[model samples]
Target chain A: MNQKTALHAFDQAVALESVGTDTFCGRSPEAYANMVGPYGGIIAATLLNAALQHDERQGDPISMTVNFAGPVTDGGYQVVASARRTNRSTQHWFIELSQQGVVAATATVLLAVRRDTWGDTEVSMPHVPPFESIDRLDIGRYLTWVKNYDFRVVQGHFDPGGAIEDTGDSLTRLWVKDLPRRPLDYLSLMAISDCFFPRIFVRKQQRMPVGTVSLTTYFHADRDSLARQGDRPLLAEAHAQRYSQGYFDHTGKLWGEDGELLATTHQMVYFKD
Target chain B: MNQKTALHAFDQAVALESVGTDTFCGRSPEAYANMVGPYGGIIAATLLNAALQHDERQGDPISMTVNFAGPVTDGGYQVVASARRTNRSTQHWFIELSQQGVVAATATVLLAVRRDTWGDTEVSMPHVPPFESIDRLDIGRYLTWVKNYDFRVVQGHFDPGGAIEDTGDSLTRLWVKDLPRRPLDYLSLMAISDCFFPRIFVRKQQRMPVGTVSLTTYFHADRDSLARQGDRPLLAEAHAQRYSQGYFDHTGKLWGEDGELLATTHQMVYFKD
Candidate 1:
């Protein structure tokens, strides 16, 4: 295994600099830059990281909703993560990302100490070829964030610079993992949850003015399960239900090697045709 | 026409007594009580209502996520809704529901002035029997919240007091509308998004302790479309992907009489086996 994993860079990017009580500063690295702002996934992971590293944090994150209210300036930003309510088993947190004294993005996260209980998977994993059967897609020139991950598209391919294929469906499935290879954790899982390509690009076969307005993710697996997935690619599927009235909704699910559901996520993206 | 709609009681229950700037007090009515606390839908709607009536609120609700940190008290509670970021076209608000001095629930809402653009629904509406064709599930004695809405199950029925049928799948389809008749709006839509029975209760014959830890909703239709849907029953479908580790996730979609998609919602519920 060629094991020069980019985990170090990922960790440095999400590591927050503490400046005050419950306040931290972070910056998006050039390797994961988007068109106008930092990659949404990295930004999300950074915000969640702030809460995880906080002194008052109680448990693991079970649910998080991040709202992109405005453009995130490409430079350094400040995050304020405050635990809004703390119960015996669960806690709620409110987080904000600000630049130049202006709020750019806001988020809410629910953390809980999970307990063992009877559980089952109701949704079946889609039958797809093994990871070794798919060819890796070249996204090095597409966006800064795309280059940081190794992606093999198993279905619904969209060529950014080629002819548009109107598949009449907005479904994309891929196997993805950190480029250099890194152990899975809450931070990495949070980033991977937002790593899907824009559904508009897949449906329309071309890029439009689109940005994710809000994102919500629910984590299903625990730390041990994630660690067991060390450096292994995750199978992910995403599709949009509606693309209308200047917005669209995308739902996605990520699964580990054993078909264990790792996370389920949903986001609404604003777009202009 | 028996125009005495359940909306009156809903409105009264959500109506807040403004005590100070951006702060209000609300109470749960006995008409919508659940096993322990009031219905999660009512609490969500009440939080959204506080932001809607706020002077600083901008545009309509595009996305809202309410986090149920702890059980809400039986009687009165205070809410503080503040606009965290106000852009030209979009605004983000953070809200908290508290009793005495302890925080009970928290929420985040994104409001936006939607623009006219090309839109389409990819998820086809589930073909179910007409609202009038299916007998309404008589849940009047099950919980107070059941009496607040008229629900007709079209698929995946479970007897609360009978032996459990372990269906391999956890899909549920139903037709539902507010009791009596009330015009469709954001508040009603918010409540309706959360009106689904717990997936555990639907999948298992008996109701184990279950509560929604967090809920998120994305609005697809605009005010004009919602106005056209006024008081009509909506075809709704909800299903779970996994139920494990003391928690499960459910996704739902609501459609109008004309098959127009109205909203998409997702929630994570805590359950004990």
Candidate 2:
């Protein structure tokens, strides 16, 4: 069986355009549908992948920031990337996600040369529970139009319907490795990052499905520990930020295997209940 | 003496040009300087404060996400915002940051009603080095342009002066908090998030004074802790995402006395140095 079965290109506005290389759209029907907008890690990861496609780019990416400038529509948009600066071990680029012919979001990436993998090869794995050990919840149980990403919570979950505010600080440790290991591209990671709400938020308040949004993430390190392994839990956390009118920002972190810092992400999620 | 205090009027944007709630030419420079972008958390937080100016938005915003659609430029851009959807205890919004006449970024926000707060919370705090006890370093010695915010490393000064072959996945923990307690607003927090970068990447990459280009964050919960003094250290994890392109993201968690999780954050940062 093929690992990633292919269909025609995505017909969604953004995802379809991503295949063209002119843009990177987070048209993933993952967990919350357009529910939470695009995942920040997806933005971080996708921008990096797109940057790699450029030959003029040098070094490895070590840092990136996705400023969720504004809402990027579910409809396709354009991305323009350019090297802002380049150094021996680090390279910087300014990337913009635009819709039609306008700018929707902006991001920057810092690529650094991978000094051949060296030193005492020790990684402190996270202490959270394993992915498969956690419970799985179907997003469809809630949002009818929302497609669900098969996700398990190693540290926390609100599925199976439970009382909330029974916990503290709204903290959670999770294992997040996507099903059908598709190389865990940053784009896909970002897409998946948009899947869930912090169990803390959902529990204490009304549940809201999310939609069209922008995101940004910082990739901590390559966490292939959950690679290809089905039933692994990807630990994640979504925190609340200041809100006004109808907007606010949130951040999440994903972990895999022995407590290793897998990925740190942020999303400009849009909430709809 | 105070330099200049800013005001964000929603009279025109919020009441008149409803969609133009978060655009430039309509925002004060102080507000503009603080946002990750036009509709970013920095400003959204300010907007949230304003949203509650009227009692309707108050009930305790459990969570909120903002969706951005157009480019909101500092010098010459327009911005807009909308509600993704709202039900019972939660609300969502769509924001567009426009520049010239194009949509640059989009964002979405989710807000929920908080009926209660976690009291006398008992939870083990994450293992973080004591920031105050650790000999701090003046980051300007290494990263000269940190004039935006004060950055202190609780432990080592992670800087890659020469060639480095990554031994394997590496991580370093740092204690970072804002300098001098000023009014904690969205822009201020947004600026603080910009300061997160793992020493690991700084130790291996090329150089320059880097700023947060794209920032995505997840907030776990709202807090009254802000009313208290901020001598606490925020634990930060900044590390690489992938080696080939040098992408990276960081996580930050803020806790209050008694070990309550006040906030958790993740950001995708673009490093130039």
Q: Relative to the true structure, how large is the alpha-carbon lDDT of every model?
A: 0.88, 0.45
Scored by TM against the true chain B, the candidates give 0.96, 0.62
Error of 1 at B208 (Å): 1.1
Error of 1 at A182 (Å): 0.7
Indicate the TM-score of model 2.
Answer: 0.51
Q: Which stretches of candidate 1 lie over 4 Å from their true place?
A: A1-7, B1-7
Task: Give per-model TM-scores.
Answer: 0.96, 0.51
| Each model's Cα RMSD | 2.8, 9.9
Q: Write the per-residue lDDT of candidate 1 for residues B12-125, one digit (tens) a residue.
A: 767888899989998866778888888888899999999999988789988899999888868889999999899888888989999997888899998999988877888999
What shift in Å separates residue A124 of candidate 2 from its native position after superposition?
5.5
Runs of candidate 2 with Cα error greater than 4 angstroms are A1-32, A36-49, A59-61, A69-74, A116-130, A133-135, A142-148, A160-166, A173-175, A179-181, A198-200, A209-215, A222-233, A237-251, A266-273, B1-273
Candidate 2 local lDDT, residue A173: 53
Number of the top-ranking candidate, with TM-score as the measure: 1
TM-score of chain A of each: 0.96, 0.67
